[model samples]
Target: MTQRLRQCPRCGTLTPAGECCGAVLQRAKPWRMTKQLVRNLHIFAMSRKGLDAETYRLQLERVGVTTSKDLRRDAYMALMRNLRALPDSPRWKPRGKGRAVA
Candidate 1:
């Protein structure tokens, strides 16, 4: 069998084909994945706990997601980096409007 070599864009190193080259080979963007996960999680949480969109948004904010575009960047990295945080149960909400709290 012959081995193939490919150049790694990260460190400008040549690595054997079919290798990870010590870098993450992301199939899709972290934000994209997190977005989808959030959507599904929202649906599930809503059905199980009566979480509305505003409530969900507030929950996300409490977990460090603070803005509409925040989820697309650093928040994405935060979610993707820590899988343990995903399964966490929703926290208690103080009595008030979600918008006012946000």
Candidate 2:
């Protein structure tokens, strides 16, 4: 939603709607995914992709992250792409709603 600038009647100062007296108003920024959640997603993908412990460690090493818990958002994205591009690993499929795991 676009914030409408409202002019203060007495002071002639413009500010965002619902606020006055020269108070600065800023839009709220969307929060990034939490690191713990990222770790869970990475681990789940690895398990579904049939990656072994050694391979998991090797992949993290390639990304310069010693552990999944230490990975930043960008690194997680890069690692996810790398995981998807693995030639030999079985592709991980997302389970649909109401579908049972095989």
Per-candidate TM vs. native? 0.33, 0.49
Determine which window of 10 residues in candidate 1 has minimal summed lDDT.
Answer: 93-102
Which 10 consecutive positions of candidate 2 have the poorest summed lDDT? Answer: 24-33
How many steric overlaps does candidate 2 have? 0
The TM-score, computed over Cα atoms with residue i paired to residue i, of candidate 1 is 0.33
Best by lDDT: 2
Over all chains combined, what TM-score does candidate 2 have? 0.49
> What C-alpha lDDT do the candidate models reach, one value each?
0.52, 0.66
- Segments in model 2 whose C-alpha atoms lie over 4 Å from true places: 1-39, 87-102
Clashes of 1: 0
